[model samples]
Target: MKGNRHPKADIEAALKRAERAGLKVTRDQNGHRWGFVICCSCNREKLVWSTPASAGMEARRIDEFTRKHSNCA
Candidate 1:
């Protein structure tokens, strides 16, 4: 995670992309800053933790995750 002044906005963008991809973003019980991205199509999920990094890094991470889990294993 790079230094990001506006991490939340970037995170929101990533979440939107995931939503468009048929994934759902949910806050995880691990903590307030932790979340889970679930692939509705395959029932696959990934856990993510937000940091004080740039939105670009967060978005990229999300893109990578979605790409990897786009299909069921």
Candidate 2:
């Protein structure tokens, strides 16, 4: 029941972390349950779900994405 619910603050914190890592973060146009993380240099983008279950893992995912695309033009 409660396992599927995510705390709003955790999701917000993850988005903030994404921004601090130099990624442009935007909430989905349709709702807050989804977000977009964009690479400022290459214009590459990734869709991230906003949820407490995934919040703690977002940083690592962002790091990997950045590293993989670091050489993009």
Candidate 3:
């Protein structure tokens, strides 16, 4: 059997993609992970947060949202 696979790898990849898309991921003083995406053209910022278990999801969501709202490549 191949055993069970871990979603950590996929989550990490998503985080990396978010960074490449200009989303900054960070953990706040409250220990919550947050993704901040800022649009230079319109000066609009999108911030999303998630617990440790779903930080990756937040990153992916922020990236997608940022791309749509901002002119990020």
Candidate 4:
């Protein structure tokens, strides 16, 4: 049920995981961190990208939802 990926953490972890997995990290033309283009081992692994807005909104929404549904979240 994990949604709205954590962006900054995603990049860091993606790089670490890629290196650990021996995958190559690549960047897009805009100097944006595109992370690992492909995972060399499984050939099916890919990055799950998410934005900070979505992540923050998701977290806040979940927090509010939980708070509304429970005594504490």
Candidate 5:
């Protein structure tokens, strides 16, 4: 959440990683532009987010799915 690029990508990258690891992504009843949840085998990693979370949160969320969980720091 500190670069010129959208930080939401970070979250999306995280989601992608989660999915690749056998996780699932789900949007709320509100039809996105809101937040999502990352579900693991055990439960959910719970990556709750909000738009303007750091600028372009939507795109950021998508990109975040590609990142590794450990890389989340």
Candidate 6:
């Protein structure tokens, strides 16, 4: 249960990556600086987080997530 302590730029970058991967992104409602990247065709999602220490990793995570779930209908 983390709060929105991460920078807004990081969150926006992650969301943009998710969008580029063809996933729908939505923010967490409980104050976490993270979002769920969902595959509409399969109705599946992956939780992507943004943190100062992991600023550069978000894109990689999104890439991996998209690849892993790419087979979805």
- Give the candidate number with the greatest TM-score: 1
Candidate 5 stretches greater than 4 Å from native:
1-7, 29-33, 38-40, 45-47, 52-73
Candidate numbers, best TM-score first, in rank order: 1, 6, 2, 3, 5, 4
What stretches of model 1 exceed 4 Å from their correct place?
1-7, 52-54, 71-73
Cα-lDDT of candidate 1: 0.68
Q: Which structure is stronger by TM-score: 4 or 6? A: 6
Quality of model 2 by C-alpha lDDT: 0.61
Query: lDDT tens digits, residues 1-73, model 6?
Result: 3443335565566566667767777767544446678899889887766443565677567667777766677
| lDDT values, one for every candidate | 0.68, 0.61, 0.51, 0.39, 0.47, 0.66
Off by over 4 Å in 3: 1-19, 22-35, 50-53, 70-73
lDDT of 4 by residue, 1-73 (tens): 2332334553444444444544544443223323233444445333333343454453343333333333221
For all predicted structures, in order, the TM-scores are 0.64, 0.52, 0.43, 0.35, 0.42, 0.61
Alpha-carbon runs more than 4 Å astray in model 6:
1-11
Order of models, best lDDT first? 1, 6, 2, 3, 5, 4
The worst-scoring run of ten residues by lDDT in candidate 3 lies at 1-10
Which candidate, 2 or 5, has the higher lDDT?
2
Tell me which of candidates 1 and 2 scores higher on lDDT. 1
**Candidate 2 weakest ten by summed lDDT:** 1-10
Candidate 3 Cα lDDT to native = 0.51
lDDT of 1 by residue, 1-73 (tens): 2332224777767777777777878765444355778987777776666653566776788888887776545
Q: How well is each residue in 1-73 modelled by candidate 3, as lDDT tens digits?
A: 1222222554446555655766554433223434344555556665544345565675466657656754544
- Cα deviation of 2, candidate 5, in Å: 24
lDDT by residue (tens digit), candidate 2, 1-73 = 2333224555556556666667777655434446577887888897776543656576566556756655565
CA displacement after TM-score superposition, residue 43 of candidate 6 (Å): 1.9
